[model samples]
Target: MLGLRPPPTAAAEYTLGSPRHPDVRVRVHWPTAQRPTPAETGGLPVLIYFYGGAWTLAGIDWLGWDRLFRERAVDAGVIVIAVDYSHAPEVQFPAQPEQGWTVLEWAHGAARELGGDLDRLAIGGASSGGNLAAAVALMNRDRHQRPIRLQLLEAPALDLTLGHVDAGGVNKAIPDVILRQMAARLVTQYLGTGRGLRRHPYASPMLARSHAGLPPAVVWTAELDPLRGDGEAYVTTLTRAGVPAVGVRMIGQTHTSGGLRSVVPAAEHLHRDVVSTCVPSTHRRWTIRIRCAPRTTGYEPA
Candidate 1:
């Protein structure tokens, strides 16, 4: 359960759809202050966010994610558009990423009307949502050249194969073997019976043969999360491929630690780090300084 609060700014709701796909519900949360018109001043950056729920739970209306979106819109001074993508075991794999790409296409076409900066657009998500965000980034690269400036992944589940999961790194409340089994089931449920679907770049971004030509990314990983290795390996792969990427390992944090911001002080710090990352920086340089000791990393422009 989460405490409900009034949204920090005005939000507009709409539905986006294509003939082949189901209609996707979208909610756009505006920052408290915005330029009167896009003609006078380029509008605020837009962050198209997806909520995490292992691909089965959570929606744009989930109280936890709603609060995060509102906070990000107000604090980062951007237009936050949350996508309620179709869930798994029903919609499955490529459908979710397809829906995500549809939103990106709409944003590009309607940026001016929505008072958003086309060039400063970004996408982000947590857990399974992160998988979709990365998948969408790959789709943008392979399908069309969308001006997506960044991909912000928090506690992302990048490798659906579950090969990179280190159950021992997860919280010990549940046994490592059990955690491994649970993870396997989630992956199986989302992937369904499709053969070799686990290796599909849209289903598992880390399995993509090439990480080059994708937008710059800011990846956040919890030290105690079983998926931490997935995030670490992804950052390494992206960097080696000559993409601008940075990873921050939050020390002593777990997979669900992000939802503990109300009690855990460090969680608030993570929020600030994310909000700062959302802001459009001059020179197109993006950097995240790890506040936690012995585990911090950053990107400095050359």
Candidate 2:
């Protein structure tokens, strides 16, 4: 369980409704520090973040990660936009993904209005959020010519079809029945009818027709998560497609560990990584060097 933390300094809220479905309501979170100003703070990169909670539970307000996102956005001199989309069982299937694209398109056009550089953009999320981010990146690459500079996926649920089997290589102590039940619930809610679930790239990004021309990516996986293999396979696909990708497996971590911001050391480390990746550099040109902390015996990259 996560402990309460002080909310981050309030940022301005912008209401954006779906153009295709005006009845559907959504909002975007913009960190206060990144507001547009003619004097300074202009031309900063934008990080559009999506939150995770399977396809049903959790919302923009459920986790305190927004505060952390704001802190990192300010510290890294980038504008952060968090989107609140409709969840499943109420809006089911392609609804959330479609809303995600709408938000992305809106953000791209309004980045300057929000004090973000249109040329430098990154998409990121955790768990289910990560899955959406990955889907968005692929969709953007295949459908449009917009530039996506980087992508960061933390414990992404890439392959919803994996069922009870551990797809990411590592396995936890959770019983198969419970895992299967949870997976079934998620799959059913996300795909609505499962009739053509396999054909939709948003439902199963791992089965995409092609992974070519995707932006450079940083894929994070937990050593104990059931979805770990999905993340691993994604990284492999990205690399094999000639895209630059980095895979990191957090030792002694689980599927929902990143959400345990208050109790997990791995969670804290993950936050640091997110900040490092999302923040824009002061120089026009940039170089990222990930220096690992010295490890003791038995600790190593998987």
The numbered model that scores best in lDDT is 1
**What are the lDDT figures for the candidates, one per model?**
0.83, 0.72
Name the regions of candidate 2 deviating beyond 4 angstroms.
1-7, 22-38, 163-173, 282-288, 292-302
TM-scores for all candidates: the values are: 0.90, 0.86
153-210 per-residue lDDT for model 2 (tens digits): 8888887776324733344355666876778777787777665784578877887888
Give the alpha carbon lDDT tens digit for every residue of 97-149 in model 1.
99999999999998889888787889999999899999999999999989888
Candidate 1, after superposition: displacement of residue 27 in Å? Answer: 0.4
> For candidate 2, what is the lDDT?
0.72
Clashes of each: 0, 3
Pairs that collide in candidate 1 are: none
Best by TM-score: 1
